[model samples]
Target: MEKTAFYTVKQIPPEETYPVRHPVLRTGLPLATCEFDGDDAPTTFHIGVYIEGKLAGVVTILENAHSRFDEERQFQLRGMAVLEEFQKQGLGQVLVREAEKEVERRGGYFMWMNARKVAVRFYEKLGYIIDGDEFIIETVGPHYVMCKKWK
Candidate 1:
């Protein structure tokens, strides 16, 4: 791995996220798991972090509301993943920050996610708080509802 890795975050089309998401997030699961609802909506945006011109990470921001949050201006962070080789390089952080900025740009003040248990600490480090009881997502195992709000 190079110490000075070059990476850029850019908004990408929803379909372009399948490759990274399927390998990083959905592994044994069906490829369909990577296709999320609202993914192709006009208000929804997908972001990919490209390193050395290869897609290394991806995150989708949907202008959708979570029932738990009563706020009207809210967005959901879905299918956030980084390639195994790309993990721990702070690319995940960059993806989330870029997604949050998009939410903020659209007048959204709240962002929430069904964060995998293993990634809770990662999201926590980025200022997201666990919002409710932990639960299982069947094939996906345990997850927690985490949220970050900004004015």
Candidate 2:
């Protein structure tokens, strides 16, 4: 899909991300389940991609370390989602790149996430590497720990 000038990406409050999260990531689950840990922490931040002034995608970043990473400064990327109509149009990539920039600005050396199995390739395309075996999170189905270290 061709890029559009109407698309914009920026930092937004964590709450602003919940709408997309609930529908895309937590379908059939309680909206509260879409709220992630450290979402309100001072060191955490959310990014939203807007198309024509309407938010079409969102991602949250937390200052948390993955057990397999030794970096003292790490950010966990979570609750990333784009509206179904916006999927495959490059909005997810825009959201991720925005989150990575924020993590780097915050002095983080690495960024990790429990990426859903189906979305693994999406993360890989953005330079994230799988770190361990895939596992299920009770209600969340299969996921793999993926990480990207700034070089």
Candidate 3:
């Protein structure tokens, strides 16, 4: 299959993102474990990248506040994951850029996430900076709170 033939990224329903989010971000856990807080909020949005009509990557953005940010508009990015077969193909970056655009359009001043330690470099390459000390999320592993500000 031509890599470009069937690739696209767009906003998707929160439920539609579960398949990719579960396997990648919460492997071996119950499907319910993949559900995130604020996923159904009016201010929350989900983005997905599809290849060959299947969900290949997913991300969730919540219009929430972080005490660390004094900005009036803050978004918490959560459940960002891409299938192993699709990594390094730029799908993750595409999803993140699209999400950032949405955030900017909605007047968001900052975006933050508890990013996995393994993915810190990836976020850094996208202009996100480590905001705090490394921490753990129970069954999950090491993570760092990373943030990016638009203004």
Candidate 4:
């Protein structure tokens, strides 16, 4: 058991973040899109938790989402997960809050993310709105585009 500290994904050594990437993609589902050139900047925004200096969890922020109705700048939340050993300890909330703070710091007014259908209630509890009908994203599963305004 260890205490958690916040970190900018970019601040962590790339190698540490890499291990959590695939695991988050697998667990987050439908909301986790395929790695389209995983190294691309627009495809990711990152935050994490470290316990005793070990990377314990990660969350990502994405911008410019694709919409059937309109194309506009929208911040997307992705890759949100805590290591198995870290679950249910409130670290997930910490990661999300920090990510939101970073988005605001970056001049981002709107935050968007595809929440897994199962996790829709979770985002809703956090003030996210579900948009469009359910859709299946390739390499991922089924999810809806969810967004929230940063106040």
lDDT of each: 0.89, 0.88, 0.88, 0.66
Q: lDDT tens digits, residues 40-149, model 3? A: 99999999888878889988999998898788889999989999999889989988888898999898768999899999999999999998899998999999999998
- Evaluated at residue 34, the lDDT of candidate 3 is 80
RMSD of each: 3.1, 2.6, 2.7, 4.8
| Candidate 2 local lDDT, 1-151, one digit each (tens) | 2246969888888889888998899999998998787999999988888898898999999998777889999899999999998998988998888888778778776899999999999999999999999899988899999999886
If scored against the real structure, what TM-score would every candidate get? 0.94, 0.95, 0.94, 0.74
**Model 3 ranges with Cα > 4 A deviation:** 1-6
Off by over 4 Å in 2: 1-4
Q: Which is the winner by TM-score between candidate 2 and candidate 3?
A: 2
Whichever of 3 and 4 has more lDDT, that candidate is 3
Quality of model 2 by C-alpha lDDT = 0.88
lDDT of 1 by residue, 25-142 (tens): 8889888888998998999999999988898999999888888888988899999989899888999998998888878878888999999999999999999999999999987889
lDDT of 4 at 55: 74
Candidate 4: deviation at residue 144, Å? Answer: 1.2
Show the lowest summed lDDT stretch of 10 residues, model 4. Answer: 1-10
